[model samples]
Target: MICCLSSLSTCVANLELKVKKNIIFRSGSNDLFKPIAGFSILLLTAWSMQILSIRFSQLLFIFFVLFALWPVARKAWRKSLEGNIFSMETLMSFASLGALMINAVHEAAVVLWLFHIGESLEHYATQRARAGVSSLMAIMPETVMLLDDGILRAVPVSQLKPGDEIEIAPGGRLPADAILQDSMAAFDESALTGESLPVEYAKGQQIYAGSVIVDRVCRFIVTSEQGCNAIDRILKLIDEADAHKSPTERFIDVFSRTYTPIIALLSMMVMIIPPFFYDQPWDMWFYRGLAVMLIGCPCALVISVPAAITSGLAAAARRGILIKGGAALEKLAEIKVIAMDKTGTLTEGRPTVVCVITDKPDDEDRVLSLAAGVEEGSSHPLAQAIIRQARKRFNDYPIAGNRQALSGQGVKGDIDGRDVNVMAPTFAPPFAPDSILQGETERLQDAGLTVVVVALENVPLGIIALQDTLRVDAKKTIQALTAMNVDSLMLTGDNPRAAAAIAGQLGMKYQAGLLPRHKVEAVYLQQIAAPTAMVGDGINDAPALRAADIGIAMSGGTDVALETADVALTHDRLAGLPELLHLARRTRTIIGQNVTISIGLKIIFLLTSMLGVTGLWVAILADSGATVVVTFNALRLLRTEKTLPQMILKENS
Candidate 1:
């Protein structure tokens, strides 16, 4: 549609140009080639846009090249295209061709040249914004391990079927939805779950695609096809939402549709108005109207907004932020509240023991040792911390006995022929420690630690302190948000104690013990005050993401959250939000500037066209020039802003 109509307009310009070239000899000796120049560009634009076979498109391209072969026509077109009114490529085309049709050759050429320059700038900006997501889609692995009859073999993932058992090695990516068949498996789900920790999988536990098996080799029974994996689902979300456009794009579309007709109508009035008021030649009025129409190309107004949005996307892509498109970037800029998850967002999601409480003689060390001994062969996070504590205390640790874990309590084992147990405080409190130790337990809990008691052979020894480690940049990020006058709130599924501890540390308001639905409700509540952005990594955070005004999912967040989110950061960085918002707001500003500049120039120039003070050449230049200026202005975003925070290191508070 765009191609066919554009060519028709080109014909109109050429008809006017031809009339002028013959009538006016003083404009230039080189003014004879206007029609060919306008004809070639319009023809190519039309042909390329028409839906056709590759062969036909190529054939049309051949004809375009034939224009180059006819050097004489090319020279005439080039000379005739150079009109004073040219803005961009369109300016040159309009000035030369429209002027020639209206008996003014120089103006049409300038418009044509200006249009091309704008197009070129807009294309560069679009490429940059599309870089990140395209790069991610490129990393999809093509092959996988196929298991059959207990024998493992390499095969294309597509060849595998459900019930096939694939042996996954440490550090290998999970290729399909499957259930773990191994005794123990540890998975790094950062890419899929956004949790910055390796999740331990037991037999019968479900595993998902895009999750890397970090340690302990395991076998999984494939239950789904390769394309139906979690990662694929996330990509599909971006595809489904592809129709979304930036605010700027919407405005430009509205303006482009109406601007040309309005200008054409006014130009006609310009011609008629002159003859009614004074004695003028019909040729003079007609030529002036043609000049007004020649300068009527809305190239700048049509392309300016998209150029700004594309430039913003491109700039975000360079910063390790994968904003899906111009629309997402624009939405992010309007975010006034950022509701962040306590675990994995503001804090490292990993839980660690940062404190210890001793109530009896060597209480802390003894309890840690017994807990570690019982958990020596376990894979749970708390167990691992105890084991590390044991190693740190003893330096060279003795071999532990066979161990077993009691679900939701603790692990158990034999230590030097003594049966030892390490369980929760409510399970085996005061087994070894005196009653005086009770105060220490309260102290640790009050200080924001989950206390797990370790008892050796039924004797309470000491208490273990476990807390989520926070991200180093969390405080600064919150501070930055505050400075921006945007509220920052921490929301979590964790217990009130843990949530309070984190919120206090960050100095932000907190909402604790929230289910996925509740998170959504909280966002809906915040929305009453202002636009909100919700960021999180867990599947539990998905509903809230969709409910928020703008949902930002960490680059490494769970597949569900990532797919549900409107904006995604590829670097897994929280700090990028501030910059992303900054960029989006600036993009809107640039678009507004482009629109104002384009329309302002036209209004002033349109008057000149009516008075015959500006020829068709200058009119074309003004029209196309606006497009190039806007494109250049939008691209300017790429050179600004540097450095975003890293996602890894430390644990959730």
Candidate 2:
């Protein structure tokens, strides 16, 4: 801005001398309208005259029309006047008014028309760039089905009141925050809670809005209303997110503010003093000053950052990602390490069978079958894995049981008039698992699998090993990050066996058995190594995410992750991570380039003005043009290729 003002002042001074000395070439100073502006007004006038259309090209003329013909021209009245006028506006306003003062109707019309055209183009470009984030409204569902007793009721999600009982059926999204009361319910909480697994809802476990129920029906007691709900609060943060100023943006603003006053004073001297000393005509010098002011307009400077931001956001949108603002984008660019959550972030959040061991030959099939029968009737990942593995080997097998899922340990049922139990050792420390299954246990454990104990009639049957496998892309994604020189680390609430299994597979660092707060320590440590990003789509991931230099929330299950993350992946995708990094780097580049271009142009132009050779019109074009160019360049982010959907509806605000 400072450079812009300086350039404008010098241009104005030199232009005045040129205008005064060349009165014969064009005595009618108003005729110096921009070429396109003049032609457009001519075309408009011809059309208007033919059809008896309204033709008040001047604002002052519009004022007269309001006074004489239309009593209610609020839009016209307000549009003709507003807040601070930009440098381009100043030049356009002056050129048109000076023309009108000299009775050059066409010149005045062309100048104003030209400015309007430029402003319109700039606005459209900006809107197009910002289209991705502006489309967030479509991602949310409208209704949250509530249940009164066992009977179901459909209601607007926004109208859900605290304590209202809501039913989240399979494939339905939870409408509001609630205490989950349905014990058999399994929620794909990545959207709200950030836990990737189909989170098993105990009798009193809490659930939040925007979570999807993957399997089994669950009922919740609504605990929060619209503004207080999970997703809504995050959306509000996006709405109120403050734009953090980059060094370039702040400097430009300050420069622009100071440069205007300095240049205006210089232009005044050029117009008045030259004529007194050199016998130049007053009208000629005055018109030259006006032309100089027009050149010094700073439209480009105004448009630069917004345009860049628009493009950056658009690019992210095309890849199914979202960043709330320029500041967020900037922060995302700085992440050197990423602390990932274990349960839902790295793994699919579903446990799968990795080992099976039995003392007797038939025991393998028999024990797994009994376990599957009870597990099939339950929602825990361990139970689901037992069923999933059983079906892969033995199909068409009949299962009979009156099942009850034991929250802390396992599921139990009466099968064939006999009691059966499938238990995780962590849940039942007193139940000594069979030593016969020890061989397979070490193999699976060594491979990072969880050993589940199965029993028939209170006697040890066998062990079915389960593990949440790393995402298919997890290894490659880590490799990509490593290649980019970004350190990768994991924070998991799982035991050391589970953490080592996953981390070993990916050749990355891991810390196991971390509680919610302990994960914060991991995030803090990574930040100490370098600027870090805590990447996880989990409710547990939120605090660490907030503490990190950047937070990235995977899109899919829990929105809590999104609320805290600097960047949100609208689509659950690991590929988007790399793409976002690419965009951040690109956005930074464009900002830097624009800043350099704006300053460089101003400096060169200012130098010319000091030599009394620069003109106002040139300064205006250069300043505004730089801004526009920067914006368009930034917008280039919308075209990046590469979108890989890993799948999740997790969130961050």
Q: What lDDT does candidate 1 reach at residue 625?
A: 69
**In model 1, which runs have C-alpha deviations exceeding 4 angstroms?**
1-98, 121-243, 276-279, 360-365, 376-379, 391-408, 411-419, 431-436, 642-653
Q: What TM-score does candidate 2 reach?
A: 0.68
Model 1 TM-score on a 0 to 1 scale: 0.68
Model 2 Cα shift for residue 566 (angstroms): 2.6
lDDT scores in order: 0.67, 0.65
lDDT of 2 by residue, 246-355 (tens): 44556667776677556566667767887899998877676666555554555666567656765775566555566766677777678788788888778888788876
Q: What's the TM-score of every candidate structure?
A: 0.68, 0.68
Question: How would you encode candidate 1's per-residue C-alpha lDDT over 422-528 as one tens digit per residue?
Answer: 77777764643346557777777776677787666676666777877787678877776776678899889888887887888889999989888889899999999
